[model samples]
Every structure is written in structure tokens, then in C-alpha cells.
Target: MLDRLDQLQLRQLRSALPRMLEPVMKPNHPTPEVMMASFLQAVDKTNKDIASFQEAHLRLQADGVFPRARASQKNSKGLKHWRASEHPDWANPDRKRSQIS
Candidate 1:
């Protein structure tokens, strides 16, 4: 059935998606800065457009296909800062590290 075929393809794509995102993920900082929230809002309709295109093809429904990158807020020296949140390491700059070995 076409539904089964789509499910299988979805599973495969899910496995490969992370590999594709690794390169795009920022190692030290979250990209597209949170200060640009207003900018992103202006283009919020882009996703709908992409989904419509995919629907026309009837292959992949890419409504939420892409991973969203975000930043966590941290207070440092009385100042608020944003850091890349994809990886755990950059999330909390002041987190205590323990020996795991």
C-alpha cells in the first residue's frame, strides 16, 4: 500500500536527518539569533508554502520535516545571553562537570 511505503520512507529519512543536521548545527552558538524572532515571524508562511509543494508531489509531507534550532537563556554577570541549545554542552555554561570515567 502507498501508506506503508510512505511510512518506510519516513523511517529511513528520520535516521538520515540527524546526519544532515550535524553540519548545520552550530557547535558553540545557536544560529539565527533569538533577537531575530521578529524576522522569523515575518516569514512564518514559508513552511506552509513548502508543505503545499510537497503535497502536490504526493511523496513526502514535509510540514515539520526540518529540525528547529533554538537557544537557551543564561544569566551571566547580570546580563542575559543566548547560547546554542542543540548540544547539551553549550546549554548551561556554568553546569558542574563530574568525572564519568
Candidate 2:
């Protein structure tokens, strides 16, 4: 039974081997200039994408909506709280705590 299984596996492998090697049989045809142009176009597109992303990110950051989530603010007990000390007004010397009327 083991010998029959091994023979079946060997036959399957032999049939699949030629298909795997088929890709290596073809030759690349693009000229160096064409390749360079394609590469440059791709690089330019990537740069434009990055620039647009950065611009959008900057705009979002300016509007205080860049991070979009507060999962990182959760504590060990899964509670989220804002720390007043991290705010700019917390360190202001002239700022006085006012009682709510």
C-alpha cells in the first residue's frame, strides 16, 4: 500500500514539474529604456501617492483627527481617561481653576 502511494505521488510530481518550469522557459523582452521609463513612472506615482497621503495626514492632524482612534489610551484595566497634565493649559502659570457656576 505504501509503495502504491509513493508511486502515485511520484506521478503527480512528474506531471506538475513541467508546468512549474514553463515560466523559466520564456525570455524577458522589455528594453532597458522601457524598463527605466516604467520604473520612473512607478516611482513618480508612488511619490505622488505619498505626497497626497502626507498632505491629507497633515490636514487631519491640524484638525485634531489624525489618529482617528483612542485604543492606545486604554489603561491596564481597559479604562480610558484623559490626563490633564499632558494638556498645554495644565502647565500654564496664569491659568486659574474656575469653579463651575
Candidate 3:
């Protein structure tokens, strides 16, 4: 969603958002930047945590919930198009050492 915005638009939104949200904000409440950062972090985790993601999907499937088909989905197929991958050296240094042994 944020990918569409240019730097100026993003700056404008960031500057305007605080004033807009101030009316209902509590004294100890998080700023929009912190909230958005946390939200984006969570969203990034959903894409990176394969084992946890698959486990959650398996549980959902057992409950008769299924993901929608991607055939009609028009977004870029980056990681979704991948079938397999090797771990980077930094990502699995212990396994790399074991393989050498």
C-alpha cells in the first residue's frame, strides 16, 4: 500500500497524520510512526516465518478454512513463485559447518 506513494506524499501524510489523530489520542498512546513501524514489522514477519506460517495454515485448513486461489490474483509473484531455496551462509552457519564435517 505504501509502495505507491512518492517521498513527498509520504512526508505530507506523516506530517498531517499526527494533527488528524491528536483529538482522540490518549496521553500515553503510541504515535502513528511507532504504530506503523510495529504493524509493518508484524507484516514482514508473516512473510519470513515459514514454519510458523505453514503451521497456522495447517490449523486453519483443519478447521475447514482455506486460502483463496491465486489464479485471479494480480500482484507480483515474488517469493510465491519459488519452489525451493538454499539457505544463505549467514542464515545457517551451523548447518553449513555440519555439511562440511
Candidate 4:
């Protein structure tokens, strides 16, 4: 359907589209560059907020607010296979003898 529009119709629709967008522009519409600048300001603020959060997190870690992690014998590293020859209990798996011999 959009493909059917001629150049003039496309131009007219392009002019009207921004007005349809939320925070609707009316008699005096802001240029696309102006909208982009507003968007950039928001992004800058978000970046600063993230930086502040990251700095606070780093401060906490440096001050040892969180306990230091200790490694245990079973502390997860990765899968390991133990030999049955070394651990005899594992050599013979549980088996049920015949109820009636």
C-alpha cells in the first residue's frame, strides 16, 4: 500500500507522521535534529547514572563490604572422575541377592 504513494504524497505523509507520534507536535513542530538532541541528552544522563552505580559497587568491593570468598575441597571447578580402584566402596555397586535361592 505504501508503494502506491507518489513523491508528493510521500512528502505529505512524512511531514504528518511526526505529529502523529507521542508528545504530539502541533502548529510548531521540532525538526528531526532537535528531537535527536533531546534523545542524546537522555542517553548522556543514563550513562552518568550507570557510572555512578558502578563506582559505588567498586567502592563496596574495595572496602570489603562483602566477605571474601573461600575455596573448599568440593568448591565447584568443573566435572572430575574419581577412580573406583582408589575408592573400593565405589567398586562394588549395590546389588539385591535372589530372594529364593
Best by TM-score: 4
Give per-residue CA lDDT, model 2, range 1-101, as digits (tens): 12323454445444554444444444563676665565566556555655555565566566655244443443336665679866768765556445222
* Residues 62-88, model 4: lDDT tens digits: 765444433433564774657877776
Summarize candidate 1's per-residue lDDT along 13-86 as a digit string, tens digits.
Answer: 44554443444353554555742553444344444444544554353233322222112123244664455664
Cα-based TM-score, every candidate: 0.21, 0.38, 0.23, 0.39
Clashing pairs in 4: none
lDDT of 3 by residue, 12-47 (tens): 444554544444354553686776665566545444
Worst 10 residues of 3 by lDDT: 64-73
Backbone clash numbers for all candidates listed: 1, 0, 0, 0
Q: What is the lDDT of residue 70 in candidate 4?
A: 34
Tell me how many residue pairs clash in candidate 1: 1
lDDT of each: 0.43, 0.51, 0.51, 0.50
Sort by TM-score, best first: what order? Answer: 4, 2, 3, 1
